[model samples]
Target: MQNEKIINYIKNWLDNYLVKTNLNGFVVGVSGGIDSAVTSTLCAMTKQKVLCVEMPIHQDISQVTRAQQHIAWLKSNYNNVSSVEVDLTPTFDAFKQGLPKTNSKREDLALGNSRARLRMTTLYYLAGLHNYLVVGTGNKVEDFGVGFYTKYGDGGVDLSPIADLMKSEVYSLAQTLNIIDVIQNAEPTDGLFGDSRSDEDQLGASYDELEWAMQYEGNPEELSSRQAEVLKIYKSLNSANQHKMKPIPICSIPSEFK
Candidate 1:
């Protein structure tokens, strides 16, 4: 891809969207990941008011450090960029405490998703406070290929600037944007579970394999065992998570009944 052309295009798109919506600016949740780094840089390039909020809920120290470093770099480079760190650890703890005890095996997964929802709530709160749009950091693989993000959580946003870019494309933009090495080099993780589990660990496949599967429309018989396994993983996730990829379902009432 022509990196410079894509970068300029996104910046101009953001500027025009802001004018059309008449919103003050954008508020992005920086997560010490490539997608967020590239996205925040693009927003900053627009020279618009961009608020980078870091909401950590018992997050790994490395992730938090990278997030702070990226935000610091952004401020130094762009005068329009600003940042805030909201420690949601206490809030998350209290929320869990208030909830009833559960023996379901899905409890851990549910709480992991809750962390993302809490951050989403925090981002929207900031956006509302400043009349800014909540900018999403999801990429093509996560947003469309496998639906890896949390629905109504990190998935909740006013606009997604990088959703069309693949993970590799996101990295290309990160390098051009001069994102901090620590972030660009760090393993991709959602940081929702307060642990060091990487995205690949959770997804059962690396982003490169998933990306290939997303675009693959070939004879399955020619594939190796590993490749076939990856394809199955990709297809299973794509089928199961269609709920996230599609618009919300609404039951239509019959006009005659009304």
Candidate 2:
């Protein structure tokens, strides 16, 4: 992809959207990942006031460091870029404590999702206070192909500048935008779990493999065992998370009843 052309297109799109909506500025949560870094950079390029928030809930120290680095980079490079660090650990802890005790993996997954929702809530709060639109950091593969994001959580946003770009495309933009080296080199993670598991660890495949599986349509029998396994995982994840990707099914009333 032509980086310059794409960048200009997105910047123009953001400008037009903000004008149409009459919003003041943009609010984005910086996660220290390539996706967030790229999104924030694009927003900053607009030369409009952009608030980059870092909401960490028992997050890994390294991840927090990377986030700070990216925030510093934004402040230094863009005059309109500002940042704030909100520690959500106490809020998360209270929510987790109120729930009934359970050792099931299902509960673990729910808690992980709750962390994302908390961050989402925080972003909206800032947006409300500042009259800005909440910008999301999900790329095409995670947002559509694997449905990797939490519904109503990380997926909750007013605008997603990189939603159409694939993971590889985001990386290309990151490099072009001169994102911080630490963030560009860091492993991709949701940073919601206590163990700090990478996205690949949770998804059972790398972004490259998952992207290929998303677009691949060939004879399964011709694939190697590992490739087939990856395909199976991809298909299962896509199926399970389809609910998050599709619109909610609304029951229509019959014409006679209406």
Candidate 3:
């Protein structure tokens, strides 16, 4: 399908969703990545209220700059677009200070996830005030293949517009939408670590490799060594993060108890 057709399809889908939900519009948490840029742009194309919020907690300067530029571009192109920057550094610091100090090795990962959850809270708070839905920016590989997103953190959203698109497809859409080059060319990152760690750095395999693994139906014995390793990594992550992909499990009581 043509990129423009896909763009219009997503815009129409967003419009229909807004009509059904009777919500005001969309509020996207812009992270200076291609996914967010494309997602926010698609929301903007619907000509509805789009609040692109940049919630940064000790974020790298490049990421922050690209987010600002993308938001500026959106506002300039679409009058319905608006933006806000919420510095959550102090809030995160306070939250950390309140918690008991821990020397566990998992603390780093825990704190990284804490950042995502904090941003999720901020997005929902804005969404509540404006009666807008929180638009998620996760792509197919992260959302369903390897499940690389943080549970209830980046994973928390009222709606996800691009979860069906692969990372490469997202890049294609970004190019079609004329997303700012700084963002389009920048490496994909969750930005939860408060540093310059790329998504590949965290996942050990690139999105292309993960996408290949996600759709691979060939025999494992026929695969190359690197492909086998990538498949292993993908499966490990997908299995470990099934809790994020699946619905919340509900334990049912025996009928005799009632």
Clashing pairs in 2: none
Off by over 4 Å in 1: none
Candidate 1, overall lDDT?
0.95
User: Across residues 1-258, which tens digit of lDDT does each residue of candidate 3 receive?
Assistant: 489999999999999999999999999999899999999999999999999999999999999999999999999999999999999999999999999988899999999999999999999999999999999999998999988888988899998889999999999998899998899889989888888999999899998999999999999999999999999999999999998999999999999999
Q: lDDT per model, in order?
A: 0.95, 0.92, 0.93
lDDT leader: 1
Clashing pairs for model 1 are none
lDDT of 2 by residue, 46-125 (tens): 98889999999998999999999999989999999999999999999999989998879698789999999999999999
lDDT of 1 at 203: 92
Q: Candidate 1: deviation at residue 25, Å?
A: 0.8
List the candidates' TM-scores in order. 0.99, 0.98, 0.98
